[model samples]
Target: MTSAALSFRYVGDSGMDETMNQQLLIDNGLPNSLAPVLSFKALDETHHVLPDVKVSTVFGSDRGNLVVPYGGSYDILRFSGPGKHDVTDVRVTVQRKTEARNPAGSHDVTTQALDSHGRAIEKFERFSAVRLINEDNFPVFVRIAYILWDQPPKGVTQQAVEVTPIGGLTSVPAHGTAVVKVSGKAAAAVARNSYGPAVSIKAYNSQ
Candidate 1:
Protein backbone atom coordinates (compact mmCIF):
# COMPACT_ATOMS: atom_id res chain seq x y z
CA MET A 1 0.00 0.00 0.00
CA THR A 2 1.17 3.55 -0.72
CA SER A 3 1.84 5.81 2.27
CA ALA A 4 2.85 9.47 2.61
CA ALA A 5 5.83 10.79 4.55
CA LEU A 6 5.22 14.02 6.51
CA SER A 7 8.27 16.22 7.01
CA PHE A 8 9.12 19.25 9.21
CA ARG A 9 12.04 21.55 10.01
CA TYR A 10 13.01 24.05 12.74
CA VAL A 11 14.54 27.41 12.00
CA GLY A 12 15.23 29.98 14.66
CA ASP A 13 16.13 33.59 14.19
CA SER A 14 19.57 34.92 15.15
CA GLY A 15 20.38 35.15 18.88
CA MET A 16 17.57 32.67 19.51
CA ASP A 17 18.90 29.83 21.66
CA GLU A 18 16.60 27.62 23.72
CA THR A 19 15.42 24.07 24.12
CA MET A 20 12.20 22.98 22.42
CA ASN A 21 9.71 20.48 23.76
CA GLN A 22 6.94 19.74 21.31
CA GLN A 23 4.25 17.16 20.59
CA LEU A 24 2.86 16.40 17.14
CA LEU A 25 -0.70 15.17 16.94
CA ILE A 26 -2.30 13.39 13.98
CA ASP A 27 -6.05 12.93 13.63
CA ASN A 28 -7.50 9.84 11.96
CA GLY A 29 -10.93 10.44 10.49
CA LEU A 30 -11.41 6.91 9.28
CA PRO A 31 -13.30 4.27 11.21
CA ASN A 32 -11.65 1.36 13.02
CA SER A 33 -11.57 -0.61 9.78
CA LEU A 34 -8.30 1.11 8.84
CA ALA A 35 -5.47 1.05 11.37
CA PRO A 36 -2.72 3.69 11.23
CA VAL A 37 0.95 2.97 11.91
CA LEU A 38 3.30 5.94 12.33
CA SER A 39 7.11 5.84 12.00
CA PHE A 40 9.45 8.78 12.64
CA LYS A 41 13.13 9.54 11.87
CA ALA A 42 15.66 12.37 11.82
CA LEU A 43 17.53 12.90 8.56
CA ASP A 44 20.31 15.00 10.04
CA GLU A 45 21.78 13.45 13.16
CA THR A 46 23.60 16.61 14.21
CA HIS A 47 20.53 18.80 13.99
CA HIS A 48 18.03 16.75 15.98
CA VAL A 49 17.55 13.71 18.22
CA LEU A 50 15.38 10.69 17.60
CA PRO A 51 11.78 11.45 18.58
CA ASP A 52 9.65 9.52 21.10
CA VAL A 53 6.56 7.92 19.59
CA LYS A 54 3.18 7.03 21.12
CA VAL A 55 -0.26 5.96 19.83
CA SER A 56 -3.62 6.08 21.59
CA THR A 57 -7.30 6.10 20.74
CA VAL A 58 -8.96 9.49 21.05
CA PHE A 59 -12.48 8.08 21.00
CA GLY A 60 -14.36 4.77 20.77
CA SER A 61 -13.66 1.67 22.93
CA ASP A 62 -10.05 0.55 23.25
CA ARG A 63 -9.80 -2.44 20.92
CA GLY A 64 -6.26 -3.45 22.05
CA ASN A 65 -4.77 -2.31 18.76
CA LEU A 66 -4.30 1.42 17.98
CA VAL A 67 -7.76 2.19 16.58
CA VAL A 68 -8.40 5.96 16.41
CA PRO A 69 -12.07 6.93 16.33
CA TYR A 70 -13.74 8.60 13.39
CA GLY A 71 -12.66 12.26 13.64
CA GLY A 72 -10.55 11.48 16.70
CA SER A 73 -7.04 12.68 17.53
CA TYR A 74 -3.85 10.85 18.56
CA ASP A 75 -0.35 11.84 19.60
CA ILE A 76 2.13 10.70 16.94
CA LEU A 77 5.49 12.05 18.09
CA ARG A 78 7.19 14.05 20.83
CA PHE A 79 10.53 15.84 20.47
CA SER A 80 12.61 17.59 23.13
CA GLY A 81 16.00 19.16 22.40
CA PRO A 82 17.99 22.38 22.24
CA GLY A 83 18.70 24.68 19.25
CA LYS A 84 17.30 24.27 15.75
CA HIS A 85 15.90 20.76 15.31
CA ASP A 86 14.44 19.14 12.26
CA VAL A 87 12.42 15.94 12.10
CA THR A 88 13.07 14.69 8.61
CA ASP A 89 10.65 11.87 7.89
CA VAL A 90 7.34 10.85 9.50
CA ARG A 91 5.80 7.91 7.65
CA VAL A 92 2.17 6.86 7.97
CA THR A 93 0.85 3.43 7.02
CA VAL A 94 -2.84 2.47 7.08
CA GLN A 95 -3.60 -1.21 7.59
CA ARG A 96 -6.96 -2.34 6.29
CA LYS A 97 -9.21 -4.74 8.20
CA THR A 98 -7.13 -5.80 11.20
CA GLU A 99 -9.71 -8.30 12.50
CA ALA A 100 -10.46 -11.54 10.70
CA ARG A 101 -13.57 -11.78 8.53
CA ASN A 102 -15.44 -14.53 6.73
CA PRO A 103 -15.08 -14.69 2.94
CA ALA A 104 -12.24 -12.17 3.14
CA GLY A 105 -12.21 -9.56 0.42
CA SER A 106 -9.95 -6.76 -0.65
CA HIS A 107 -9.45 -4.02 1.95
CA ASP A 108 -6.41 -2.15 0.68
CA VAL A 109 -6.14 1.65 0.56
CA THR A 110 -3.08 3.88 0.55
CA THR A 111 -2.16 7.61 0.30
CA GLN A 112 0.70 9.49 -1.34
CA ALA A 113 1.78 12.99 -2.46
CA LEU A 114 2.91 14.06 -5.93
CA ASP A 115 4.46 17.32 -6.94
CA SER A 116 3.30 19.50 -9.82
CA HIS A 117 5.49 17.40 -12.12
CA GLY A 118 3.77 14.24 -10.88
CA ARG A 119 6.94 13.14 -9.14
CA ALA A 120 6.54 11.68 -5.64
CA ILE A 121 7.72 14.13 -2.94
CA GLU A 122 8.39 12.54 0.44
CA LYS A 123 10.17 15.50 2.10
CA PHE A 124 7.38 17.86 2.94
CA GLU A 125 5.22 18.69 5.97
CA ARG A 126 2.56 20.52 3.94
CA PHE A 127 1.40 18.92 0.69
CA SER A 128 -1.57 17.80 -1.39
CA ALA A 129 -2.24 14.70 -3.43
CA VAL A 130 -4.67 12.76 -5.57
CA ARG A 131 -5.32 9.24 -4.24
CA LEU A 132 -6.12 6.51 -6.75
CA ILE A 133 -6.95 2.91 -5.87
CA ASN A 134 -8.93 -0.08 -7.01
CA GLU A 135 -11.78 -1.41 -4.90
CA ASP A 136 -12.48 -5.10 -4.34
CA ASN A 137 -15.80 -6.93 -4.66
CA PHE A 138 -16.91 -5.15 -1.49
CA PRO A 139 -18.23 -1.60 -1.67
CA VAL A 140 -16.32 1.04 0.23
CA PHE A 141 -16.38 4.72 1.20
CA VAL A 142 -13.65 7.19 2.14
CA ARG A 143 -13.51 10.19 4.53
CA ILE A 144 -10.69 12.63 5.31
CA ALA A 145 -9.94 15.40 7.88
CA TYR A 146 -6.92 17.40 9.06
CA ILE A 147 -5.47 19.52 11.93
CA LEU A 148 -2.61 22.04 11.83
CA TRP A 149 -0.54 23.85 14.47
CA ASP A 150 1.82 26.72 13.73
CA GLN A 151 4.53 27.49 16.27
CA PRO A 152 5.58 30.97 17.34
CA PRO A 153 8.88 32.63 16.39
CA LYS A 154 10.60 32.03 19.73
CA GLY A 155 8.16 30.77 22.34
CA VAL A 156 6.44 27.37 22.38
CA THR A 157 3.02 28.91 21.87
CA GLN A 158 1.13 27.34 18.92
CA GLN A 159 -2.00 28.36 17.04
CA ALA A 160 -4.52 25.80 15.80
CA VAL A 161 -5.89 25.88 12.27
CA GLU A 162 -8.98 24.47 10.62
CA VAL A 163 -8.41 22.10 7.73
CA THR A 164 -11.01 21.75 5.01
CA PRO A 165 -11.55 18.59 2.98
CA ILE A 166 -11.01 19.07 -0.74
CA GLY A 167 -13.19 16.20 -1.79
CA GLY A 168 -16.26 15.34 0.23
CA LEU A 169 -17.48 11.78 0.75
CA THR A 170 -16.45 9.33 -1.99
CA SER A 171 -17.85 5.92 -2.87
CA VAL A 172 -15.86 3.05 -4.34
CA PRO A 173 -17.60 0.67 -6.66
CA ALA A 174 -16.93 -3.05 -6.44
CA HIS A 175 -14.06 -4.21 -8.64
CA GLY A 176 -13.57 -0.67 -9.88
CA THR A 177 -10.97 2.03 -9.45
CA ALA A 178 -11.61 5.22 -7.46
CA VAL A 179 -9.68 8.48 -7.42
CA VAL A 180 -9.89 11.63 -5.28
CA LYS A 181 -7.68 14.58 -4.44
CA VAL A 182 -7.45 15.77 -0.82
CA SER A 183 -5.91 18.97 0.52
CA GLY A 184 -5.99 21.20 3.65
CA LYS A 185 -5.31 24.79 4.71
CA ALA A 186 -4.16 26.26 8.00
CA ALA A 187 -6.49 28.56 9.87
CA ALA A 188 -3.70 30.94 10.90
CA ALA A 189 -0.05 31.30 9.90
CA VAL A 190 3.07 30.84 12.04
CA ALA A 191 6.79 30.59 11.50
CA ARG A 192 7.32 26.89 12.29
CA ASN A 193 4.46 24.58 11.24
CA SER A 194 3.63 20.88 11.56
CA TYR A 195 0.41 19.17 10.50
CA GLY A 196 -1.23 16.66 8.12
CA PRO A 197 -4.61 15.44 6.91
CA ALA A 198 -6.08 12.06 7.95
CA VAL A 199 -7.92 9.62 5.72
CA SER A 200 -10.33 6.75 6.47
CA ILE A 201 -11.78 4.08 4.20
CA LYS A 202 -14.59 1.75 5.25
CA ALA A 203 -15.85 -1.31 3.36
CA TYR A 204 -19.40 -2.60 3.16
CA ASN A 205 -21.18 -5.42 1.32
CA SER A 206 -23.28 -4.53 -1.69
CA GLN A 207 -27.01 -5.17 -1.18
Candidate 2:
Protein backbone atom coordinates (compact mmCIF):
# COMPACT_ATOMS: atom_id res chain seq x y z
CA MET A 1 0.00 0.00 0.00
CA THR A 2 2.61 2.53 -1.02
CA SER A 3 1.67 5.99 -2.41
CA ALA A 4 3.27 8.91 -4.30
CA ALA A 5 2.66 12.68 -4.13
CA LEU A 6 3.34 15.70 -6.41
CA SER A 7 3.36 19.49 -5.87
CA PHE A 8 3.91 22.58 -8.09
CA ARG A 9 4.23 26.41 -7.87
CA TYR A 10 4.28 29.38 -10.31
CA VAL A 11 4.71 33.18 -10.06
CA GLY A 12 4.74 36.06 -12.58
CA ASP A 13 2.62 38.70 -14.36
CA SER A 14 -1.11 38.55 -15.25
CA GLY A 15 -0.36 37.50 -18.85
CA MET A 16 1.14 34.25 -17.62
CA ASP A 17 -1.00 31.11 -17.41
CA GLU A 18 -1.07 29.23 -14.07
CA THR A 19 -2.41 25.86 -15.11
CA MET A 20 -0.87 22.41 -14.28
CA ASN A 21 -1.39 18.78 -15.30
CA GLN A 22 0.02 15.44 -14.00
CA GLN A 23 -0.51 11.65 -14.04
CA LEU A 24 -0.54 9.15 -11.14
CA LEU A 25 0.35 5.43 -11.11
CA ILE A 26 -0.17 2.94 -8.24
CA ASP A 27 2.09 -0.10 -8.06
CA ASN A 28 0.24 -3.28 -7.16
CA GLY A 29 3.01 -5.17 -5.38
CA LEU A 30 0.86 -5.84 -2.31
CA PRO A 31 -2.65 -7.24 -1.91
CA ASN A 32 -5.57 -5.87 -3.97
CA SER A 33 -7.74 -5.37 -0.85
CA LEU A 34 -6.15 -1.99 -0.15
CA ALA A 35 -7.99 1.07 -1.50
CA PRO A 36 -6.53 4.37 -2.72
CA VAL A 37 -8.01 7.89 -2.48
CA LEU A 38 -7.13 11.12 -4.32
CA SER A 39 -7.13 14.61 -2.79
CA PHE A 40 -5.64 18.02 -3.69
CA LYS A 41 -5.52 21.79 -3.09
CA ALA A 42 -5.32 24.70 -5.55
CA LEU A 43 -4.64 28.19 -4.14
CA ASP A 44 -4.80 31.73 -5.58
CA GLU A 45 -2.42 34.08 -3.71
CA THR A 46 -3.29 37.24 -5.61
CA HIS A 47 -6.83 37.35 -4.22
CA HIS A 48 -7.71 37.76 -0.53
CA VAL A 49 -10.99 37.62 1.45
CA LEU A 50 -9.76 38.86 4.81
CA PRO A 51 -8.83 42.48 5.67
CA ASP A 52 -11.07 43.62 2.79
CA VAL A 53 -9.11 43.41 -0.49
CA LYS A 54 -10.47 43.06 -4.03
CA VAL A 55 -8.92 41.05 -6.87
CA SER A 56 -7.52 43.22 -9.67
CA THR A 57 -5.73 42.60 -12.99
CA VAL A 58 -3.35 45.56 -12.88
CA PHE A 59 0.17 44.98 -11.54
CA GLY A 60 2.05 47.36 -9.20
CA SER A 61 0.70 50.66 -10.58
CA ASP A 62 -2.12 51.12 -8.05
CA ARG A 63 -0.10 50.12 -5.02
CA GLY A 64 3.03 52.04 -6.00
CA ASN A 65 4.81 48.66 -6.08
CA LEU A 66 5.75 45.83 -8.40
CA VAL A 67 2.82 43.39 -8.40
CA VAL A 68 3.45 39.74 -9.31
CA PRO A 69 0.89 36.93 -9.72
CA TYR A 70 1.63 33.62 -7.95
CA GLY A 71 0.03 30.38 -6.72
CA GLY A 72 0.43 26.54 -6.22
CA SER A 73 -1.12 23.10 -6.96
CA TYR A 74 -1.01 19.80 -5.01
CA ASP A 75 -2.40 16.28 -5.53
CA ILE A 76 -2.53 12.75 -4.09
CA LEU A 77 -3.61 9.41 -5.70
CA ARG A 78 -5.04 6.30 -4.08
CA PHE A 79 -6.04 2.83 -5.43
CA SER A 80 -5.86 -0.91 -4.75
CA GLY A 81 -2.80 -2.52 -6.30
CA PRO A 82 -1.14 -5.87 -6.92
CA GLY A 83 0.82 -4.45 -9.88
CA LYS A 84 2.63 -1.22 -10.73
CA HIS A 85 0.93 2.20 -10.73
CA ASP A 86 2.55 4.67 -13.11
CA VAL A 87 2.17 8.46 -12.76
CA THR A 88 3.62 10.42 -15.68
CA ASP A 89 3.21 13.16 -18.29
CA VAL A 90 3.36 15.97 -15.72
CA ARG A 91 3.56 19.57 -16.99
CA VAL A 92 3.63 23.02 -15.31
CA THR A 93 4.60 26.45 -16.70
CA VAL A 94 6.11 29.10 -14.39
CA GLN A 95 7.06 32.77 -14.84
CA ARG A 96 10.32 33.67 -16.56
CA LYS A 97 11.49 37.19 -17.38
CA THR A 98 12.47 37.46 -21.06
CA GLU A 99 13.26 41.17 -21.29
CA ALA A 100 15.70 43.48 -19.52
CA ARG A 101 15.38 46.35 -17.04
CA ASN A 102 17.70 48.88 -15.44
CA PRO A 103 16.60 48.05 -11.88
CA ALA A 104 15.42 44.46 -11.80
CA GLY A 105 14.30 42.56 -8.70
CA SER A 106 14.74 38.94 -7.59
CA HIS A 107 12.56 35.79 -7.61
CA ASP A 108 12.66 32.76 -5.31
CA VAL A 109 10.68 29.48 -5.17
CA THR A 110 10.77 26.46 -2.82
CA THR A 111 8.91 23.14 -2.26
CA GLN A 112 9.02 20.69 0.68
CA ALA A 113 7.02 18.08 2.66
CA LEU A 114 6.84 17.38 6.41
CA ASP A 115 5.52 14.61 8.62
CA SER A 116 3.39 14.84 11.79
CA HIS A 117 6.57 14.99 13.84
CA GLY A 118 7.59 18.16 11.96
CA ARG A 119 10.48 16.47 10.13
CA ALA A 120 11.14 17.33 6.50
CA ILE A 121 10.97 14.31 4.20
CA GLU A 122 11.46 16.14 0.89
CA LYS A 123 12.67 19.64 -0.15
CA PHE A 124 13.63 21.78 -3.23
CA GLU A 125 14.52 25.46 -3.67
CA ARG A 126 15.61 28.16 -6.26
CA PHE A 127 16.49 31.82 -5.69
CA SER A 128 17.51 34.93 -7.71
CA ALA A 129 17.68 38.56 -6.51
CA VAL A 130 19.30 41.79 -7.74
CA ARG A 131 19.67 45.44 -6.80
CA LEU A 132 20.22 48.45 -9.10
CA ILE A 133 19.76 51.38 -6.73
CA ASN A 134 19.93 52.37 -3.04
CA GLU A 135 16.14 52.64 -2.63
CA ASP A 136 14.34 49.76 -0.94
CA ASN A 137 12.28 47.62 -3.35
CA PHE A 138 9.45 45.36 -2.22
CA PRO A 139 8.90 42.41 -4.54
CA VAL A 140 5.66 40.39 -4.53
CA PHE A 141 5.94 37.04 -2.76
CA VAL A 142 3.76 33.85 -2.66
CA ARG A 143 4.01 30.36 -1.14
CA ILE A 144 1.86 27.19 -1.35
CA ALA A 145 2.02 24.01 0.78
CA TYR A 146 0.57 20.45 0.47
CA ILE A 147 0.07 17.41 2.75
CA LEU A 148 -0.40 13.71 1.70
CA TRP A 149 -2.50 10.93 3.23
CA ASP A 150 -2.47 7.11 2.90
CA GLN A 151 -5.54 5.09 3.96
CA PRO A 152 -5.28 1.38 4.65
CA PRO A 153 -7.79 -1.43 5.34
CA LYS A 154 -9.75 -1.71 8.58
CA GLY A 155 -8.02 -1.76 12.00
CA VAL A 156 -5.39 0.71 10.73
CA THR A 157 -4.75 4.16 12.22
CA GLN A 158 -4.49 7.28 10.04
CA GLN A 159 -1.08 8.97 10.14
CA ALA A 160 0.02 12.54 9.49
CA VAL A 161 1.55 12.90 6.05
CA GLU A 162 5.10 14.17 6.06
CA VAL A 163 4.92 17.05 3.82
CA THR A 164 8.07 18.10 3.26
CA PRO A 165 14.46 36.80 -0.02
CA ILE A 166 15.48 40.25 -0.92
CA GLY A 167 16.76 43.40 -2.36
CA GLY A 168 17.14 46.30 -4.57
CA LEU A 169 17.38 49.91 -5.61
CA THR A 170 18.40 52.16 -8.34
CA SER A 171 20.46 54.85 -10.08
CA VAL A 172 19.36 54.64 -13.77
CA PRO A 173 22.74 53.16 -14.74
CA ALA A 174 22.68 50.08 -17.01
CA HIS A 175 20.52 49.49 -20.09
CA GLY A 176 20.56 45.67 -20.08
CA THR A 177 17.96 43.23 -18.65
CA ALA A 178 17.90 40.55 -15.95
CA VAL A 179 15.99 37.32 -16.52
CA VAL A 180 14.73 34.74 -13.97
CA LYS A 181 13.13 31.34 -14.54
CA VAL A 182 12.05 28.46 -12.18
CA SER A 183 11.09 24.90 -13.09
CA GLY A 184 11.47 21.33 -11.73
CA LYS A 185 9.84 18.11 -10.50
CA ALA A 186 9.41 16.62 -7.00
CA ALA A 187 8.30 13.16 -5.78
CA ALA A 188 7.69 11.46 -2.39
CA ALA A 189 6.69 7.98 -1.22
CA VAL A 190 4.72 6.84 1.84
CA ALA A 191 4.10 3.40 3.29
CA ARG A 192 0.85 1.59 2.64
CA ASN A 193 -1.75 1.46 5.47
CA SER A 194 -0.82 5.00 6.52
CA TYR A 195 -3.51 7.70 6.52
CA GLY A 196 -2.76 11.42 6.25
CA PRO A 197 -5.08 13.99 4.62
CA ALA A 198 -3.48 16.62 2.34
CA VAL A 199 -3.45 20.39 3.13
CA SER A 200 -2.48 23.65 1.33
CA ILE A 201 -1.70 27.20 2.62
CA LYS A 202 -0.06 30.40 1.29
CA ALA A 203 1.12 34.01 1.97
CA TYR A 204 1.94 37.06 -0.22
CA ASN A 205 2.70 40.81 0.00
CA SER A 206 -0.61 42.73 0.01
CA GLN A 207 0.75 46.26 0.12
Candidate 3:
Protein backbone atom coordinates (compact mmCIF):
# COMPACT_ATOMS: atom_id res chain seq x y z
CA MET A 1 0.00 0.00 0.00
CA THR A 2 2.27 2.76 -1.29
CA SER A 3 5.27 1.90 0.82
CA ALA A 4 8.37 4.05 1.07
CA ALA A 5 10.56 0.94 0.87
CA LEU A 6 10.25 -2.74 -0.10
CA SER A 7 11.88 -6.03 1.02
CA PHE A 8 11.93 -9.84 0.46
CA ARG A 9 11.92 -13.10 2.44
CA TYR A 10 14.40 -15.61 1.03
CA VAL A 11 14.04 -19.26 2.03
CA GLY A 12 17.08 -21.36 1.14
CA ASP A 13 20.66 -22.20 1.96
CA SER A 14 23.21 -19.47 1.12
CA GLY A 15 24.29 -19.55 4.74
CA MET A 16 22.42 -16.37 5.70
CA ASP A 17 21.38 -15.85 9.29
CA GLU A 18 17.73 -16.59 9.99
CA THR A 19 17.47 -13.18 11.62
CA MET A 20 16.83 -11.08 8.50
CA ASN A 21 20.35 -10.28 7.33
CA GLN A 22 19.27 -7.55 4.96
CA GLN A 23 19.73 -3.79 4.64
CA LEU A 24 16.15 -2.87 3.85
CA LEU A 25 14.85 -4.68 6.94
CA ILE A 26 17.52 -3.05 9.06
CA ASP A 27 16.94 0.42 7.56
CA ASN A 28 13.21 -0.06 7.23
CA GLY A 29 10.89 -1.55 9.87
CA LEU A 30 10.84 -5.17 8.63
CA PRO A 31 10.92 -7.84 11.32
CA ASN A 32 13.69 -10.35 11.93
CA SER A 33 11.69 -13.59 11.62
CA LEU A 34 10.84 -12.85 7.96
CA ALA A 35 14.24 -12.69 6.37
CA PRO A 36 15.69 -11.99 2.92
CA VAL A 37 13.43 -8.98 2.30
CA LEU A 38 13.88 -6.62 -0.63
CA SER A 39 13.02 -2.95 -0.03
CA PHE A 40 11.70 -0.73 -2.83
CA LYS A 41 11.58 3.04 -3.03
CA ALA A 42 7.96 4.29 -3.11
CA LEU A 43 4.71 3.18 -4.65
CA ASP A 44 3.72 4.48 -8.09
CA GLU A 45 1.52 3.83 -11.16
CA THR A 46 3.43 0.71 -12.26
CA HIS A 47 3.70 -0.47 -8.69
CA HIS A 48 0.76 -2.87 -8.69
CA VAL A 49 2.44 -6.31 -9.02
CA LEU A 50 1.37 -9.94 -8.81
CA PRO A 51 2.66 -12.74 -6.55
CA ASP A 52 4.21 -16.23 -7.17
CA VAL A 53 7.08 -15.74 -9.61
CA LYS A 54 10.39 -17.46 -10.48
CA VAL A 55 13.90 -16.20 -11.37
CA SER A 56 17.04 -17.86 -12.75
CA THR A 57 20.61 -17.40 -11.50
CA VAL A 58 23.52 -18.44 -13.75
CA PHE A 59 27.02 -18.56 -12.30
CA GLY A 60 30.24 -18.49 -14.34
CA SER A 61 33.92 -17.77 -13.93
CA ASP A 62 36.03 -14.76 -14.84
CA ARG A 63 39.17 -16.73 -15.65
CA GLY A 64 38.15 -20.08 -17.09
CA ASN A 65 34.44 -20.12 -18.06
CA LEU A 66 32.39 -21.27 -15.10
CA VAL A 67 31.29 -20.44 -11.55
CA VAL A 68 30.32 -22.62 -8.62
CA PRO A 69 29.12 -21.94 -5.11
CA TYR A 70 27.51 -23.68 -2.13
CA GLY A 71 24.13 -22.00 -2.78
CA GLY A 72 21.85 -19.40 -1.24
CA SER A 73 18.65 -17.39 -1.67
CA TYR A 74 18.71 -13.82 -3.01
CA ASP A 75 16.22 -10.93 -2.89
CA ILE A 76 15.44 -7.72 -4.83
CA LEU A 77 14.28 -4.16 -4.14
CA ARG A 78 12.77 -1.27 -6.14
CA PHE A 79 12.94 2.49 -5.65
CA SER A 80 10.23 3.92 -7.89
CA GLY A 81 6.47 4.30 -8.19
CA PRO A 82 3.90 2.52 -10.34
CA GLY A 83 2.46 5.80 -11.64
CA LYS A 84 -0.74 7.86 -11.38
CA HIS A 85 -2.87 6.60 -14.26
CA ASP A 86 -3.79 2.93 -14.54
CA VAL A 87 -2.15 1.35 -17.57
CA THR A 88 -2.02 -1.87 -19.56
CA ASP A 89 1.61 -3.01 -19.33
CA VAL A 90 5.03 -2.10 -17.96
CA ARG A 91 8.55 -3.26 -18.94
CA VAL A 92 11.86 -3.00 -17.04
CA THR A 93 15.53 -4.01 -17.32
CA VAL A 94 17.61 -5.13 -14.35
CA GLN A 95 21.33 -5.84 -13.82
CA ARG A 96 21.85 -8.47 -11.15
CA LYS A 97 25.48 -9.16 -10.30
CA THR A 98 28.48 -7.55 -11.99
CA GLU A 99 32.18 -8.08 -12.65
CA ALA A 100 32.57 -9.87 -9.36
CA ARG A 101 34.74 -12.78 -8.27
CA ASN A 102 33.64 -15.18 -5.59
CA PRO A 103 35.86 -17.16 -3.31
CA ALA A 104 35.27 -20.60 -1.90
CA GLY A 105 33.15 -21.02 1.26
CA SER A 106 31.56 -17.55 0.90
CA HIS A 107 28.96 -15.94 -1.33
CA ASP A 108 28.47 -12.48 -2.84
CA VAL A 109 25.42 -11.44 -4.79
CA THR A 110 24.40 -8.52 -6.99
CA THR A 111 20.99 -6.91 -7.43
CA GLN A 112 18.55 -7.80 -10.22
CA ALA A 113 15.43 -5.86 -11.20
CA LEU A 114 12.00 -7.29 -12.04
CA ASP A 115 8.94 -6.22 -13.96
CA SER A 116 5.38 -6.15 -12.59
CA HIS A 117 5.28 -9.92 -13.07
CA GLY A 118 8.38 -10.54 -10.91
CA ARG A 119 10.67 -11.72 -13.73
CA ALA A 120 14.40 -11.08 -13.71
CA ILE A 121 14.69 -7.99 -15.93
CA GLU A 122 17.86 -8.10 -17.96
CA LYS A 123 20.24 -5.27 -18.82
CA PHE A 124 22.78 -7.19 -20.90
CA GLU A 125 23.22 -10.09 -23.30
CA ARG A 126 23.71 -12.96 -20.79
CA PHE A 127 23.64 -12.76 -17.03
CA SER A 128 27.01 -14.48 -16.70
CA ALA A 129 30.06 -14.11 -14.44
CA VAL A 130 33.11 -16.04 -13.21
CA ARG A 131 34.60 -16.67 -9.81
CA LEU A 132 36.84 -19.08 -7.91
CA ILE A 133 34.90 -21.54 -5.83
CA ASN A 134 37.72 -22.64 -3.54
CA GLU A 135 41.30 -21.58 -3.03
CA ASP A 136 42.72 -24.58 -4.91
CA ASN A 137 39.56 -25.65 -6.69
CA PHE A 138 39.00 -24.71 -10.32
CA PRO A 139 36.13 -22.56 -11.50
CA VAL A 140 32.71 -24.15 -11.96
CA PHE A 141 29.55 -23.14 -13.78
CA VAL A 142 26.38 -22.64 -11.81
CA ARG A 143 22.78 -21.54 -12.18
CA ILE A 144 20.20 -20.33 -9.62
CA ALA A 145 16.47 -19.74 -9.60
CA TYR A 146 14.50 -16.55 -8.83
CA ILE A 147 10.87 -15.67 -8.14
CA LEU A 148 8.86 -12.50 -8.93
CA TRP A 149 5.33 -11.50 -7.96
CA ASP A 150 2.80 -8.72 -8.39
CA GLN A 151 1.99 -5.95 -5.90
CA PRO A 152 -1.43 -5.13 -4.65
CA PRO A 153 -4.99 -4.17 -5.17
CA LYS A 154 -5.48 -7.84 -6.09
CA GLY A 155 -7.60 -9.27 -8.95
CA VAL A 156 -4.98 -8.02 -11.39
CA THR A 157 -3.47 -10.06 -14.25
CA GLN A 158 0.32 -10.16 -14.41
CA GLN A 159 2.62 -12.17 -16.66
CA ALA A 160 6.33 -12.56 -17.42
CA VAL A 161 6.60 -12.75 -21.20
CA GLU A 162 10.24 -12.48 -22.14
CA VAL A 163 13.83 -12.41 -20.82
CA THR A 164 16.40 -10.83 -23.12
CA PRO A 165 20.18 -10.59 -22.84
CA ILE A 166 21.78 -7.19 -22.44
CA GLY A 167 25.55 -7.66 -21.78
CA GLY A 168 27.82 -10.66 -21.08
CA LEU A 169 31.33 -11.95 -20.43
CA THR A 170 33.23 -10.84 -23.53
CA SER A 171 36.76 -11.20 -22.25
CA VAL A 172 36.93 -14.91 -21.58
CA PRO A 173 39.59 -16.57 -19.40
CA ALA A 174 40.44 -13.16 -17.97
CA HIS A 175 37.35 -11.41 -16.65
CA GLY A 176 33.68 -11.80 -17.48
CA THR A 177 30.38 -10.06 -16.76
CA ALA A 178 26.69 -10.79 -17.23
CA VAL A 179 23.55 -8.78 -17.98
CA VAL A 180 19.90 -9.62 -18.63
CA LYS A 181 16.66 -7.90 -19.68
CA VAL A 182 13.15 -8.91 -18.58
CA SER A 183 9.77 -7.64 -19.78
CA GLY A 184 6.19 -8.08 -18.59
CA LYS A 185 2.60 -6.86 -19.03
CA ALA A 186 -0.15 -5.86 -16.58
CA ALA A 187 -3.83 -4.97 -16.91
CA ALA A 188 -4.72 -1.99 -14.73
CA ALA A 189 -8.50 -1.76 -14.86
CA VAL A 190 -9.13 0.59 -11.95
CA ALA A 191 -8.15 4.15 -11.12
CA ARG A 192 -8.15 5.72 -7.68
CA ASN A 193 -5.89 6.88 -4.85
CA SER A 194 -4.68 3.65 -3.32
CA TYR A 195 -1.37 2.03 -2.47
CA GLY A 196 -0.27 -1.27 -3.98
CA PRO A 197 1.06 -4.33 -2.19
CA ALA A 198 4.62 -4.74 -0.97
CA VAL A 199 7.36 -6.12 -3.29
CA SER A 200 9.65 -8.89 -2.10
CA ILE A 201 12.41 -11.27 -3.34
CA LYS A 202 13.59 -14.65 -1.99
CA ALA A 203 16.34 -17.13 -3.03
CA TYR A 204 17.83 -20.35 -1.65
CA ASN A 205 20.29 -23.09 -2.62
CA SER A 206 19.89 -26.86 -2.97
CA GLN A 207 21.48 -29.35 -0.62
Best by lDDT: 1
Q: Model 3, stretches more than 4 Å misplaced? A: 1-105, 114-176, 183-196, 200-207
For residues 1-207, write the lDDT of model 2, one tens digit per residue.
122221232222123222111212222222111122222222223321122212111112122232222221122222222211121122222222211122222322233334444344432211212212212243323222223333434433222233321112213223332221111221222231124333321111222
Cα-based RMSD of candidate 2: 19.6
Clashes of each: 0, 26, 61
- Looking at model 1, the pairs that clash are none
Q: How many pairs of residues in model 3 come into backbone collision?
A: 61
Evaluate all candidate structures by whole-model CA lDDT and list the values in order: 0.35, 0.24, 0.25
Tens-digit lDDT track for model 1 on 49-140? 34443322211112322333333333323333532244433333443323212221235434444444555554134444445344457645
Model 1, CA-based lDDT = 0.35
- Sort every candidate by lDDT, greatest first: 1, 3, 2
Give the TM-scores of the predictions, in the order they appear.
0.31, 0.19, 0.22
